[model samples]
Target: MYTLAVCAEMVFRDLPIEERARRLHDAGFQVEIWDWTRHDLAALERTGAVFSSMTGYIRGSLTDEDDAAELLRTAEESVKAAALLGCPRLNLHGTGLDGRGLPVDPVAGEATGPMWIAAHRTLGRVAELGESAGVVFTLENLNTAVDHPGVPFAKAADTLALVAAVNRPGLKMNLDLYHAQIGEGNLIELVRRAHGLGLIGEIQVADVPGRCEPGTGEIAYPAVARALADLGYDGTVAMEAWASGDDDLALDRFRTAFTV
Candidate 1:
């Protein structure tokens, strides 16, 4: 069966982390946290909710030298935090071009060859640390056109190439389908390619036009879910969308759509 992990940070923002964990556990879903530092580890543990994945300690440009160094350090700290929380995966993003540590317009001076090389070097080091800590690091792709304008690594192919270049056993791709749909429309093809290469570490979903529940958008999530199942993707498929109405109802639709 496909495992589902809900982004508590987005879905249950009003509730305490502990309460979110308990509610998710009761609702039969795993939890994905964006920032582990904001949560109470002990409280999360008490609920016994499985932590599907979390954002990396540092969320900035891996292309810049100074930021890359800080990213490595943050990764080491994140490894310790993951161990403490019993989480196995950490997700990362390529902040922007030139390491300004913020999302930059992709149109304004795209990432160059040197930036790619720097990313490989930085991620390679982080992957090494993750390997020893029993944690895997996943580089995620964001949509630069709308939600995350100017961020680098917005394409699945480019991010996967980075993972391949890093060539670390602990580093893989976190394919967020919503962003992929906006940035690149060929979702199924990308998923197939990533799965065939064993590059996909995790998957997150929403729909286009609005980052809301699946059925409310144009993306056919049921088909996507079935495709993933056909590819034998056993990793967590996280629900990282906004709910328009009843939260529980939104979750029910998510489960129904993806439960292959």
Candidate 2:
């Protein structure tokens, strides 16, 4: 009942990215990626894979004045990269994440009032960029308690607040359930709340604890799938987790989990 995609960055690790894209394509799924700059865009374009989304900027923060400007500049460049792959939704974060997936300069505990204010202003400008470029930008949530400790606006609730505050058609929430299950417990209600507002551009998923494929951990994805279907949410639900075992089998489980 929804478009399915798998993150190439998380799956099929042994193959080249182009091949990974092709593999997902051949397996009847669109592909998602992180950091378009690291790949040869020409090769990716040649893979004939329908891309769902990619990281929207190279380096910048939503809460910094200078970095916000850099975010806008680099985001414009990211739009060009997305064009090559026909990716319609570009992903964003509160700040630039390092190679280790840690925030460049984290906001310990809570961000200052000025930081939130700056983020709002920066995201407003980011929405303008998305509007003019004809691409939607999705601000993703991360769990500070686990994978991404100390990142500002890392909670799903905080992200929802910011995206709702911006309230632009060009900007929307990525609404990752994996992170949400860690940071916030109510998946069905969160989906309902975000969907009810028309604020969700995509829903990313993985089972909790291990960050592995569905059915390999604690999340009841089939129920989540049914909830999305019940809400008439027909947008993308992408797998953004590593395989627990054989990659193909992992893909199979992911498909079955969402097979409502």
Candidate 3:
């Protein structure tokens, strides 16, 4: 069975981060978060929620040499925080994103040849760090069309290419279906290809039109869930979505969508 988790940062807006995590825990879901640097790790640990993943870098970009150094340094720090939270996976992007989900230094379009080479080199070092720290680092896909514009390698195909090229167990792709829908539709095949290549680390979901829980928008999530089950993907299927109305109801809808 797929282990269902929820991003605490997206739901239960009325509560504190720890409280949000606790609520998810009590509701029978694992928790996910972003930017561990901004949160009180100890307080979150006290909530007794099982953390599935969190943002893996504080400040770094894979675009240049100096930025890559910063990325590796902060990634090392992030590993420590992940250990404290007992989180098994850490999430990364092509560049460091600001609080608003915009890349700090956004790229205009597709990556150049040199940029691709640098990203591959930088991710090799990141894999070594993850290997040493006993955690997996996942590069998540983003939809430049909506939430994250100007972020290079924001497509699932690009992310899969990078992870598959590196071909290390320590590194894998965070196959986010919500972004894939906007950036590239045909999600069932996307999941098939990514998992078929043994490159996926996690799967995140939210509805299109609105970044809310399943059933509120166009995605036939139950079909996606059936596809996952058919593929024997027993990994995490997470709700990285906001509450359409009531938080608990949204969670229920998410659970229903993936309960194949």
Candidate 4:
């Protein structure tokens, strides 16, 4: 079976981090965060909620040779923070080309083949660092069409390929269903393919169109949840979506839809 974890940053925007963790824990859910740098680790521990994962590093481009050192440095710091918060996994985004936040090649105006090579080498080193720290690194696929425009690893296939090229035990994929649905329609197939290859280490969910609770959009989250369970996926399925109504109701819908 799969457990549900809510993205505290997105769902509980107004509340303090400690209160957010408390409420989610009280409601029998785990919590995930974008960053653990500012949160009270002790208070979160007291809530008895699992810190599923946190973003590994932001702002640095994994595909840029010049930014490789900085990226690795930030990732090292993230591993330490994850250890402190009792989180075993870290999520990373392919920031931009050349660490300049330009998204695409400034001259070619699109992603080039050489970028992938640099990304593979840089991520391999970061994963090596994570392996010694007992932390796993997940490269998350974002939707360049909407949520994350210009992100290099927006496609599920590309992210999967990157992880495969790295071929590190500490490296894996953070498959976000919402982004996958937007960027590519074959959600279940992608999940099955990635799981079969043992590339998927973490999962996140949000319905398409509105990016809200499962039932609030076009994607059938219940079927997706069942597919995950059937595939023997035991990782946390984080609700990384916006709330449409009562937070409790939104979470209730998520729990009911993914109870398998």
TM for every model, in the order presented, reads 0.94, 0.99, 0.99, 0.92
The candidate, 1 or 2, that scores higher on TM-score is 2
* Poorest lDDT segment (10 consecutive residues) of candidate 3: 105-114
Say what the RMSD of model 4 is: 2.9
TM-score (C-alpha) between model 2 and the true structure: 0.99
Per residue, candidate 1 scores C-alpha lDDT tens digits across 1-260 of: 56898988767657887887788878999988877777778788888888889877654467778877877887787887887778889989886333332464243557788888888888888888888888899999887777776676668878999998888888999999998998888899999999898888999998777888788889999999889989888888999988867888888989988977
Residue-level lDDT for 59 in candidate 4: 46
Candidate 2 colliding pairs, count: 0
Q: List the residue pairs that clash in candidate 4.
A: none
Clashing pairs in 3: none
The residue-by-residue lDDT of candidate 4 on 127-198, one tens digit each, is 898899998999988777776667776688889999988889899999998999998989999999999999
Off by over 4 Å in 1: 96-107
lDDT of each: 0.82, 0.94, 0.95, 0.82
Off by over 4 Å in 4: 96-109
- RMSD per prediction, one decimal? 2.6, 0.7, 0.6, 2.9
TM-score of 4: 0.92
Clashes of each: 2, 0, 0, 0
Instruction: Give RMSD (Å) of candidate 2 vs. truth.
Output: 0.7
| lDDT at 93, model 3 | 98
Q: Rank by TM-score, descending?
A: 3, 2, 1, 4
